[model samples]
Target: MTYDLYIGDRMFSSWSLRGWLMFERFGIPARTQPVGLYSGTMKQDLEPLAPARLVPVMRTPEGTVIGDTLAMAETLAERHPDAGFWPVDPEARALARWLVAEMHSGFTALRGDCPMQLHSGYTDFTPSDAVCADLARIEELWSLARTRHGPEGPWLFGAYSLADVFYAPVAARIAGYGLPVGDRAAAYVARHLADPAFRRWRALGLTKSYDPMPYAMAVTHGPWPGPAPRKARAVDTGPSENTACPFSGKPVADFLELDGRVFGFCNPACRDKTVNDPEAWPAFMALL
Candidate 1:
């Protein structure tokens, strides 16, 4: 059975990204319903899911509405035992829960100052003292997780777990705003930005237009080196056929040349995914 996921604008709604990942990355089937995060209809959009008036709200197949990222995560974990939402190891599981909880409640400065914008990266954005402190705490938690279960993979708990889901948007904020994170954290952010699920979400987000622009900063370092095709503005004269994003069917101004064929995607994440797995390109094209 498919679950109902209510989400806000993908490009800016950090929690929405986390909620989408809970199903997209896992085996859970979910049908997403877009909520008007910027259209001044969030209140009306969330009438059915009352008492939990927030983006990324989830209604179970059985019609149980769940709010809050942490609570939703826990509920999904409880419902799907074999999904591996949490780490398998006892210690890693406990620590992963701790990380998710911290991210949900803590890091006010970083959350407020550097909102998640997948458009472009700020070249020389400076972090406030509070933001810096939050980054340090984040690194500390990541380091601890790596030291414990990192012998397996690049993810926080070795495998893709809820810890990664919770921090994925935080990673986006760091990379998008060009926050001064250490090498380890920077690497983690890179990984999150490169995930295919994130790519699909971002590509779809590109199809949406924002009025007045959400997070317009005066001191933008530059367009974040994200999947957005604007970075490829220099190559405007690509093949005519490759002018559409393969994932979302949107017009792509910028495209990537892969293996004798030009492939265009709305963002770098989609291009990277197709480049890394050329075999999957046909499936994505079929969707378009």
Candidate 2:
């Protein structure tokens, strides 16, 4: 069908992740493109992206471009009904749509406070009451779906469907941050945390630039205590050792922090690990 999908860093691009999962899970043929986010150039960078400050934009051979995660997924599923992107049962499909939509429009408090950061390293930052309330609401929503739809499958409404894709990023955060959740939600997360598509996406997320720093980079890179300063011991090195790759912990210029910028990314996603935990960042420099 000649589909081209644009995405952001796997670490921080939650919306993009959902759309990408749909394409991957269904084995759809598509080309993937990355746009940097923390480079202090989102508006400029996305100028060519056509009408938006977002990622995960999809374009078809017919010259139609679709924005927004759910909108894009729905469009693709419609064209490839045989692909079975949505649920087959009328009742189940309806419920799935409702949940997916709920995710799209609601969760303002959580979205504002937590913000999604796949690579952001966890800091001891405390979430606000509003944010916590949002989390609680989200948990309740997930709990209801599984309870009412558990018989269908292990997924929200049973089986891996669009609803799960819509909530995929949230699910990732719940697992990564170890957020407060109920038993059912926790079980669902355990299974989802192990999903092939999700794993593959996260694995790759650890590989791309998030444009801004991703929380994941914090997982591997840090204010590396560059070797304990030579204690007046015979001067050792002519030149200091090079910094390591933030994402893989490998020494490479490909993952660099310029001038000790806190949020700058070798790849935006890598930076997510740091940005997610602002408290962990010394607030002395700006990556963007």
Q: Pick the candidate with the highest lDDT.
A: 1
1-288 per-residue lDDT for model 2 (tens digits): 588888876767788888798898787888887776665666676677669669878887787888888779889888889887877888768878888998999888766656566543343446678767877888887777776765555888777888888887777666555566778777777777667566556646645543344443233322211111111111212221334433344433222233343222344344443332322222212223
TM-score, one value per model: 0.82, 0.69
lDDT of 1 by residue, 210-286 (tens): 77889888875675565443222223346635666766777876665543455566775566545443443455556
Alpha-carbon local distance difference test for all models: 0.81, 0.64
Q: Which stretches of candidate 1 lie over 4 Å from their true place?
A: 227-282, 285-288
Give the local distance difference test score of model 2.
0.64
- The number of the candidate with the highest TM-score is 1
What 10-residue stretch in candidate 2 is worst by lDDT?
224-233
